[model samples]
Target: MFAQALRDILQPLPPKCDIPQDEQLQEAMNTLEVIVSLLLKEQFDTWRYEALDGILLTVAQRRDADTAFFGGDCILITDQTVSPIEVEVTLGGGGAGLVRVCCRVGEKQDGKLMRHSYDKEHRYRTLIWQERDPHHELEWMYFVERMYDENGR
Candidate 1:
């Protein structure tokens, strides 16, 4: 169910004619809130989660009049963990046509900055997640474990 929900949320937006880009970006931000709620329910003793709202900016470089940038972070918290994995989302930047989602572990894990992009045409594609993975498993958990292992936890 989690995997399916992630897939649905990450699905590409409709064409600009069918749905305005601003509306599409807003819908994506709303869906991210839902996903964060789901993540909160999956907490265990070793780790918990929190969502920090990102800033909405309307700058001259943006192309759409109604489009304001939206973004946020999902932080994974753990004991003895000074640096947590931050899963971030960005809508409307220089590349206003694509919604960018990235997971940054920390300076220690600089080599593993996972980046995913959602556009209007193609179905969602991610670099690390596989369809055959367990439905209840989230991609972020993999990074959390890696962070722990690398830190000798």
Candidate 2:
């Protein structure tokens, strides 16, 4: 099972990996959710909140040369409450398809930084400046919400 999962993840790219930019952002958000969910389950189960916080810092610091992670922005969480966390991510697009993209990052638990996606789907996340004129193109925007199973102590 592990081997198969690895194979699926390490699978080669398609002949032309052309996709919408919004799709790319959505995929990234989903990926983060699954990863954070699994990691939190493991950490929270073993060491509780302490383990969760410790592992979060550790995980956020991992990245490759192309997909680097950085402390772009952060929020402070103090109160012990059960609620969804919301975040906004703005990335200036480069290369071919899109010139900029934005996405919401935090959820109910926490947020982490990782390698940025270079997929063409980033085009969907681009923001438009229709207010100015037809020749106006602003950065993209996205709204993400992190929902917990319950809202309680």
* Winning model by lDDT: 1
Model 2, stretches more than 4 Å misplaced?
Answer: 1-21, 46-64, 70-153
Which 10-residue span in candidate 1 carries the lowest summed lDDT?
Answer: 54-63
Candidate 2 local lDDT, 25-139, one digit each (tens): 3345444444334444443442133211101110121122112121111222222211212222222123111111112333222242222222332222222111234353222
Cα deviation of 153, candidate 2, in Å: 33
The weakest ten consecutive residues by lDDT in model 2 span 50-59
Candidate 2's C-alpha lDDT?
0.25
Per-residue lDDT for 37-147 in model 1, tens only? 334344433224434232121111222322222212222332222222334433432323324333433223344423222222112222122232435433344232112
- lDDT for model 1 comes to 0.32
- TM-score of every candidate: 0.25, 0.23
Which stretches in model 1 have alpha-carbon errors above 4 Å?
1-21, 44-153
